[model samples]
Target chain A: MKQNSLFLDRATIVSPHVNGWDEFLASLNCQDVISFEEDWRAQLESLPMRSRRRLSPQILLAISVAEKIHETLPKETAWVFASSVGEGETLNVILDALGTPEKAIQPLRFQNSVHNAASGQWTIAAGVKCPVTSINAHNYTVGAGFLKASMQIKSENCPVGLVLYDAPLPYPLSASHKINIPLGVGFALKPEPSANTIAELKISYCKTPNPMPFASLPQIPENSYNPILAVFPLLKCLAGSPQEDIFLGLNKDYGLCIKVKQL
Target chain B: MLQHPRTNNCGITHSSIVTCLGYGRSSHLLALREGRSGLSNNHGLDLQFDCYLGKVPDVEGIGFPSRVADFDNRATRLALAALVTDGFEQAVLKIRNRWGADRCGIVLGTSTSGVEMLEKTYKAIPENGAMPEDYSTRHHDNLHAITTFLQEYLGFTGPGYTISTACSSSAKALVDACQLVESGLCDAVLTGGVDSLCMTSLYGFESLELMSKVPCRPCDASRDGLSIGEAAAFMIVERDADGYLKLSGYGESSDGTSMSTPPPDGSGASQAIKAALERANLTPNDIDYVNLHGTATIVNDSTEAKAVETAVYRSVPASSVKGAIGHTLGAAGAAEAVFCQYALEDEVIPGNTGLIDLDPALLPNVSESCRNGQLRHVISNSFGFGGSNCALVLSR
Candidate 1:
């Protein structure tokens, strides 16, 4: 575990309540509930119109958070994008079209339906040829993505970017898989600590006798379900300082134990 | 495919595959060695045009244990069938006992998971846009359902997840599984992929005009498009211990070029291949065989040919198992890894099953029939949608 520790260079968050790290910390510090903001979408509008037009909300929010962290990341950084049910809206559109008489599936929507669409779009937008992967662990997506990123940093010995995002599934399907809030969190993690490092984290896997429950978490709006919300505790820890190691529920029987040190 | 030092101490202890070629590694090896193809006229789905499909026989016929019965679906069923094959289940249990259940995690890949159930459920909706109360999206509709199902069924309690990068999904699973063991995160990881046939892919490819009207003829001048297939390939990658093949090296890259189309120059694919070679401590000249990600799509085949030419010698024997089993999509990587294993174990290069009228501009040694040869180091390539690419190197 000592060798697995990596530096968290920077982090970004986007949701209805907050759009960046400072805003997130402010909301946590104040304990005030707030409404959704369109700032993330507004920021994306600055990109080329051709790329932004067909982008799904899931991708837009994910890219917004990633773009925030990308500015300070190395150009060769690899990316790992995680989501539970990716492009749910896009899938709804396709499923709806499948039942229609025309059965006319939009070419772009079909292409975007893939889980890796957001990662691919970011690569093209950033003109990066670095390694990339899209991950899904149902509700365990954040744990899975973070594990991949940290392992990549250890194996490749380079900077790795992790983006976790999920939007509400369109109705009907949404009822079956409940994720009402749209959240995206990006982290720029490195193999070595530097002056810009915000936190140092060492991740280890263990058979958790009693996995931490969501009820114990700090009250954040809509944090009960969304897999992207799994990062909240770690984020809160970085924002301030926590004396104990954080145990995140990855599954029913296993957990990702993170020891974080504020730097 | 970067300049990192090679890491060792992990190898594939056991594996199982269920494809149109049939169940277990023996069936696939026999088919590959005999130049037999599993493609037939499309009958699994109702499509408007003529095409061939690598449909597994009686996927719905496989019964599940009562513990996992509720989680049953086409994808999970496919995985269940593989889990019981080739002694893979026994291998997993051995590893679990050796390194506690929590030390054995699962990391799988899939393009479209058990979405077939969702498509079926959607068709039966009562117009209220609400799923049936009994439907378990957590076990059947989600991408990680397969992983969760397998984890519960196998009693693995470690870090389990699924990677869904379109066609390159499972290939990357092998890469991650190797890393999990090397990083000391897990003693062993059950890795591979399972993507069953669904309307999403059948119609999705049709929308993109990437479906073929006949059996896919990979690397053939007359190749029109791909023939979508379904499969589940699972393998136990563990630390140390004697195994049949070593996962020597792997490379992954995003084309960052296009969603559905690979870059014409194949630069992304070349980079992955070169990085794999460098990590394996081998040069292009040391490669014995290459398993290509030939979907038979015009651009994909041409671009992959260019990649092989630039990264590996054009003269090295390379063949795509897709022509034999159709494009297994997410399963292609692990399935082809099994093919690479067969090439190393049996020392035979799989034939290009549907390939005739070979493209004049492609590799010179795309074998039209299986040939016995001495094989040591082999590479398998899997490039997916969003121009995601992964190449893996395996050695005997």
Candidate 2:
């Protein structure tokens, strides 16, 4: 990896466990047990009703996180959206529709079924025409997204908005698909340190026989399976005290190591 | 800080493709040279519509290497078929040996990775119970299945992922590959895209009323819509390597206009095209030929025409191979990149194969027939659903 470090200018998480980044950090360290609820739907009140109805939970969660980050992001920030199975809920509906004799599918649902649905919808809604990409990296989605976003920050010299989300598949499909919870994380990565910088991150890639275990937040139960939370350990580090280097496995032989320093 | 000027160091040493036009570079070249269409009447899906399709013949029967046979699907099979062709596998092995597996990354693009298998599995789902015994989501349904399967089969585990930006997926994958090498992240990258035809896209496009009953005639006055095709194209890109073709530059942009269409002025497309030319440090005049992303849909053709006009500031010889290969969606970008590579090598301008009466609005830009020419730099445009636009500049 290059020596140039990325600063987390703005970071947030959308999940059933926490409402805001501050609360997430506080809950992580709090000894009292906290019960978290899903409030993403209520947050969608700001969007048009048509979008709210048509968007699957995955897209809605992604857009919600993006909207939160957009408040603090630069005007020219590029976006990199990552998910293991984008719009899986929409796909399940389409599959079910296709299996029927009528084989009728809604035009809106069909249009929103592409993997870039969240990126497309968010960009269109925000009227931001910068460079945007959507990624699907399976188990390594978060690491892959961070690497892609960091590379853009390094090469293009532009702040990049990174959003990663994963929602459970519907019904019998869910049995096959591993993720069972709706979760998302967003970060605005800048090439240089800024006033809003949460941490300075140095990213590198290496091959190791044993990958580091995923970091978990005490507030959320069974949080390791969701792909988006792969960065939770890094988030935990950013939320509180910085500690050991975090390794994000890209594949069997190689992975990305993120060394963070609290700013 | 000065913006990093895009580099032209990544060279494509070897590439392979499996399109409806047939397998390998030679087959596509012959078809492009003759202005022949590979599209035929749609088969197998039993759709209510009457559109043609650019289906690769007998992809289902293609077998996989036994070691990774568990990950077998039509898309991966199609990829393997192309991977072994044109010595692409041998070339990849050479690169892998020279630069360890960890140094060789894979970035693939696909709109429908293994959706066909997913559709099949969905159909075979036991009534109210679980999925069939053999269904594997990781191997057969996920968008990353193609890259995952290839890595498992070929024995490389570098930083790899799948980019799915509709039609621009593979083209963007190419851009990511270039960035990986330029950023010193990897020594060599396997970049390309694969998409197999499935019921989802067919019926989905049909739902949107974008399915052309007849073979697509992009840039033609009476152009109706697009014919969905299936293809897999792969390439080995290395930094500052000795090769006939180099990825000179690339630009990606979002329309931020609509999920299904671009704005009338084509501002988003123009941005990508202009960015590509600027990154390449070339004037519009430097571009020898243009591979138009002419999907035959009326709005797409006219807007793309204006976008090209706005960016190039001149009328350049341009054609859309969609008429020949059909709209390959995610694979279209990489497939067209290979087409651009051949154009650079053979000095031939691919014809707008399905054009009969050119839309007067486009005027003089759209080529009706394949022609030979002196070529240096060419641009391939891929604009996908969700207003995703990507332009790639390739040079010899």
Best by the lDDT measure: 2
Report per-candidate DockQ.
Answer: 0.69, 0.70
Interface RMSD of each: 1.8, 1.9
Local error of candidate 1 at A150, Å? 0.7
Error of 2 at A136 (Å): 1.2
Q: Give me the runs in candidate 1 sitting further than 4 Å from their true place.
A: A1-3, A29-42, A209-213, A220-224, A241-243, B1-3
Candidate 1 chain B lowest-lDDT run of ten:
B1-10
Q: Give the chain A TM-score for each candidate.
A: 0.91, 0.90
Model 2, runs deviating above 4 Å = A29-42, A209-211, A215-224, B1-4
CAPRI accuracy category, model 1 = medium
lDDT of 1 by residue, B1-396 (tens): 234668586788888899998998789888987888888894657766678889988787887788778888888989988888888888889889999988888999898888888888888886765788899888887889999998888899888988889999999999999988988878889999998888888888888898898889998999999887889898888888575589999988889878888899899999999888988989999998999999898899999999999999888899888888899888889888888887898889888988889898988898889999999999999999888999999998
lDDT of 1 by residue, A30-144 (tens): 2322344433352573359887878888888778878888977888888899998887878788878777766778888998998888888888788879889999987778888
- Judge candidate 2 at residue B277 and give its lDDT: 86
lDDT of each: 0.84, 0.85
